[model samples]
Target chain A: MRIGIYGFGSIGRLVAREAVKRGWEIVGAIDIDEKIIGKDIGEILGFEEKYGVVVSRDVEELIDADVVVHATSSYLDKVYDQILSLVRLGIDTVSTCETLSYPYYRYPVLARKLNEEALRYGVTVLGTGINPGFLLDTLPIVLTAPFNIVEKIVAKRSLDASKRRKSFVEKIGIGMDPEEYMKALREGKLTGHVGYAESVYLIADAAGIHLDKVEERQEPIIADKDMIIGEFKVRKGEVIGIKGYGTGYKNRKEIIRLEFHAYLGAKEYEEIMVIGTDYEVRWRSTGTPGDQGTVAVVLNIANIINDLSPGLLLMTDIIPFKPFFKH
Target chain B: MRIGIYGFGSIGRLVAREAVKRGWEIVGAIDIDEKIIGKDIGEILGFEEKYGVVVSRDVEELIDADVVVHATSSYLDKVYDQILSLVRLGIDTVSTCETLSYPYYRYPVLARKLNEEALRYGVTVLGTGINPGFLLDTLPIVLTAPFNIVEKIVAKRSLDASKRRKSFVEKIGIGMDPEEYMKALREGKLTGHVGYAESVYLIADAAGIHLDKVEERQEPIIADKDMIIGEFKVRKGEVIGIKGYGTGYKNRKEIIRLEFHAYLGAKEYEEIMVIGTDYEVRWRSTGTPGDQGTVAVVLNIANIINDLSPGLLLMTDIIPFKPFFKH
Candidate 1:
């Protein structure tokens, strides 16, 4: 099958290399960076420059491909309009945009517009990736499949932030004053990316629940010692990280609480749980070096695109969500 | 304390007797039945007459007591106006009406108006009962306190239908046609009660989650079997029960799903779960005879009213939610 990478960012390049390794043709590449435009795809990805395909900034040039992989920026509210424009032109698309996985929860109008446009063009749109997609959607479905009597579902994703990028570290308010970080969060300026709410919606939709309410909350980090990262210095007892969570209720009663935590210098763990009348099942895995688990979960759904129906699909709907590596 | 019983129903009589047992003076009782209007409270309750206070149909007379236990009809919307009128008179009030527990979820405007009036008068108004009050609200909170790091919360309550009342059996279509039952549910004519949604909301509030969406769903009975109770013959394959659930979401993701189940002639079980990083805790209790668990939960809360805050409260917010009876 022929494929196109819609943005030449780190994730886009990684997906491109993976697709090529799987015998799919990298027919076209798109990137707005002048430094990489017209350059060989392999060179931009730090691979030995062997593939003859070159990157271009032209959207029209890449629109003709069989499939498009959208590993672009995380600011979905700004890029979704353009993406929907491409979707309207009959392109099957998969995105890593944080908000796209369950856009209906946050951007319902945009989600519906994209769905309608995709249907008009006879294409499909899906959002899939690490946290919201895997832990929230896929893993819960997989863990619950063994039981015939499923009662409740819960998911938790925890990460240590010491090895993360500087941009992420700074945005999470690590090395900043505690009060200032809280102020920024209250103003919605320093809050984490939006998708945890979408994850709850996706899972509830899958489970046939008409939820009454979904709530979000965050807890600030309290550091006991000063820490430094790059040029920034964080004081003792300053806010260094956040733990974000969402809850699903049936008839105004709590049935599930899905938690996502990211920290600057902390321990790591991710778990998905299903509670039933006679049994309880759980799946947990520690974060690997460089967050490879995230990449594995995103790519695991690539081979099953044909089975997915039209409209917006989250990771739980697309993949078997079982222990892929174990299988 | 002087207490008056409004409505000569089963719950009203029981509460009055319980109050008498606690040494509180029964000022009088009120009901619409003309035959019982002039009768003594003990005589109406099938006990030898002792308390000289006679039953009256007058609402003004009922409101004259220091406290009014409003255990009137179950249809709250029809009687809310009168209840509010009583609240406006500054009388401390408690009701057995299920809808009053989370009035905001069902009738937001009325709940707000009643709360405003109660606040203005500095008089406490509470909606209390077994299912919505204790099972959904108080149970989940008490289960989570031992855990150091809570990642998820789920509560489930299930009961056998054989021991339920005629009203519950008929409402769930135990002896009726499936088509009619489903139609009634879809039209919102067969809503079992209103507090399940409120229970989830109260739990989320206590857990410190500000959910964006709370969804509710119902599961109709689809099994094939005949259930016979007294002279009533419930046909095979008819809905003998219903399951109601709610979930709360944050950041577009699900964090909790709360469930309540009522069965007229089935097996019985109730469970509460708390999923955390180091421990997963679950509390399970079997249903008592004649739907007595519900009565137990309600009476248990009533037994601790003096220690409880005077204002309205959810199950999780109450102190006695922990294991009240050690087996």
Candidate 2:
């Protein structure tokens, strides 16, 4: 199958390389980054050979591709036009947009428009990734297939921030003081993880459960003593990393919760606890790499996007088992 | 939704009770037991209140139910006529029949005919339960959504035989002589577990992986010393329980494996290991009750069976995700 990569960011590059590794043809690539716009896709992906597919800034270059893997942004509103253009081109596209995983929770208006636009053009547009699409949300829903009645759900992902990419560490404010980190977070300077409530809503909606309120928050993790992590050093009583949480409530009682932790020296693991009537299933895994996990989810999704109905869809629409549906 | 229970045995009764508790109407029930054929389902379920729905051997009484939950047998061939009758009546149905979960592997001709019949009548027919339907097969496939390329999968379910019902203990040939257990198993007096290859085929089919060969085996687990377990006494070297395995291979390399253990004093848990290109994920959970698990799976499927397209659908076709597909 011919494929296209639209973001050319770290995730996009990884997807292009993996798609090629899977023996699929890379038809074209689109990126706004001038540094690599005219370069061969092979060189950009650090391959020994050139793929002969050059990175272009024009979305039209991907017109002939069967599917385009969009890894540009996290919010549906921000990438609304980018996805809209791809839909009009009649290309099946799966994205890494966090909010798009459950757009109605945050962008009901835009979601309606996209759904209509995609149906008109007869193309499928999907948003999925590791956390919002799988681990913290979709996995929980799938794990609950054996449950009689789900009462509460808690899904968690904890990663070592020091081991992540430099950009990720900087985004979470690894070297900032506690007060400074809080100030920056409040001022939108140091944004922590996104898509907590997206995960919560996705799981809740898949289970046919309702929540009156959904909330998300992030805070800095303070260090006790000086330590060196990666290329950075931490002082006593300073910020080490970030911890974030999302919770869903109904009638003033919590029904779903999601936890994301990325800190130096953090134990890496993913846990999903599903508490149902007369049974509780707790599934814990040795954590997966976020960057590679996205590539896997996207590529795996690309293989089946053509089979899906044309519309703005989420991971729930494509998974092959019967999810809870109230008839 | 109005429901019908076919084969008001243990699983069927449990489903009836759970459905009533969920506020769904138990319109009718069918069972072959002459003693309870004319009895009220509520009383048979030990509920003080009468539901006014009587258990009858005639399938015609359940023609009005929106859906029927069939728990008669494990083999699809044995229940083919029963399921086909429900389809002909224009009612959706979900069954706990083990091989029916992936009938193409065992009864290809019946599967095709059933699919056509269900489609002709505009009703969905499904086969699902805890073992073949969820843990060993569907759960493993769901857990691999985050992986890029799944190279191998291993799923295991271990339960305590002593905690299960007397019939289950007898089915596994617990407290029998080792040689007698083997003879009984060979003579078909004791059938340890059904649906190993069915689970293998279901998971393999979902993951879009091809296995050239599939094999299954069961053996008795012997006791080392004198012991007492659940109203039974065991001598040294006697049978305590059973262990079974199913394996799928591609080019003689194992790609999928399933393990089932129901032994006295066994640690109860479920584990699924997904080994992919560059990552491996292991999800272990506290054990779920088998009888109740079947009830949960059937009820959950009952809630969504109407949403599914009319066909002899397995768990794979109705699940709500883009299971791997090769374009």
On a 0 to 100 scale, what is the lDDT of residue A131 in model 1?
Answer: 57
Runs in model 2 with CA error above 4 Å? A320-327, B320-327
Residue B77 in model 1: lDDT: 88
Model 1 DockQ, alpha carbons vs. true complex = 0.01
Error of 1 at A99 (Å): 1.8
Docking class of 1: incorrect
What is the per-residue lDDT of model 1 for residues A103-128, given as tens digits with 9 covering 90 to 100? 87777888888888777777777777
Q: Write the per-residue lDDT of candidate 1 for residues B21-64, one digit (tens) a residue.
A: 54668786878888788888877767775578888887677555
Q: Which CAPRI tier for candidate 2?
A: medium
Against the true structure, whose DockQ is highest?
A: 2
lDDT of each: 0.64, 0.86
DockQ for every model comes to 0.01, 0.56
- Fnat values, candidates in order: 0.00, 0.64
Number of clashing residue pairs in every model? Answer: 73, 12
